[model samples]
Target: MGEVLQKRFPDMVALFTGLGFLTVLAELVLMDHREGIRILAPLAAGLGAGAILLGLGFPRGRVWATGLLLLVGGMGLLGLVEHMQEALEASSPSVVRLVDEEGWEYPAYPGPLREGEKEGSPPPLAPLALSGLGLLGALALHARKP
Candidate 1:
């Protein structure tokens, strides 16, 4: 079993990475990229695809795969930071409510939804998934180097 796994590790990595990228792509598509920053999501998918292709035994595959993985990994880290910041911003109180002697309606009260009332912050840990995948793929590719 050990020998078999050793021989097929690269193939396994490529297969799992491809599947992960496809899942991420589906999520990004469903979420709809209306903002400029959201472009990174699709870009990561494209880069991951390229890296997977290179990892599959192309000429100089290891070099290209490693480079792309590093690039995407860095992007993922940056995205993680950006997402955290956005979450912080979303959680921070944007408006100060001044309640006088009269009772002021609480924002969290169970009532009709306000027009365009936005949802909670984006999942802060989402970007870390990409970063992890990038680093994992990079490590696997490097380990396979002759």
Candidate 2:
């Protein structure tokens, strides 16, 4: 079972790599953000690295897997940064737009005005911290030899 899992894991990673790249590509090209996008480069790099790592599954797959996990952690950190920025923006009206009819419009930010602001913590931070820990574990495992 252990050897079978090891053999199948890389194939799963390859499938996930293809799907993730497509999703990110779609977001980059299609989704329109009210505020300008940030952290595109780091996320892109991570995705690219992951795809390469997934592709290199035939030999030294464990090394590539370690690299893939690191990149995943880096991308998660980027997301945490984004959520923190959102938390800041939640307090103030950072942007204003003028419309011919409405005169001025402020896109709603999460806050006391928005429901559930204080109920729960920012979503990304939890997973991001977990990712960091996982990255560390991956590094330790990579360094250890059987």
Candidate 3:
């Protein structure tokens, strides 16, 4: 069992890292259709492709997988920090004005707002978690002897 696991560890890490990239790509495509997605989408897709290639036991698979995982993990950490900051700032009863899709303005919280609560989209926790998992898996693979 140990030998089998050691032999397949890199492949497993690469596969999971690819899945993580795909998750981020899907999130960006579905939830965020901003103009910047044109660049981000393709970049994410490329990363996912690279990860899959690495999983196929390429010559530099370890390097590619490690680099991609670290990059995604770093980005997720940055986004998590930003979201935490926003959440902290939002933990107050403040009147928020929002525009509807039909170009109508309305208060976000019509009734009495509670402290440390707001009506807004939640943070991208899924991607953050996935990235962290991928990073850890990559690190584990890196630690193993090639």
Give the number of the best model, judged by TM-score: 1
**Stronger candidate by TM-score (1 vs 3):** 1
lDDT of each: 0.77, 0.51, 0.60
- Across residues 1-146, which tens digit of lDDT does each residue of candidate 1 receive? 99999897877886688678778877888888446887897789778767876876674778788889888888888888888998998888555455657777444434554796667888888987777778877877777745
In the range 72-134, model 2's lDDT, one tens digit per residue, is: 667666767877876676556545444566566656543364552344334545435425433
Candidate order, TM-score descending: 1, 3, 2
Across 65-114, the per-residue lDDT of candidate 3 in tens digits comes to: 66775675665566566567666776654567999899999867557546
Judge candidate 1 against the unseen true structure and give its global Cα lDDT, from 0 to 1: 0.77
Candidate 3 lDDT at 26 equals 70
Give the higher-TM-score candidate: 1 or 2.
1
TM-score of each: 0.81, 0.43, 0.58
Model 3 C-alpha lDDT versus the unseen true structure: 0.60
Can you list the residue pairs that collide in candidate 2? none
Question: What TM-score number comes out for model 2?
Answer: 0.43
The stretch of ten residues in a row with the least summed lDDT in candidate 3 is 33-42
Task: Please state every model's RMSD to the true fold in angstroms.
Answer: 3.1, 9.9, 8.8
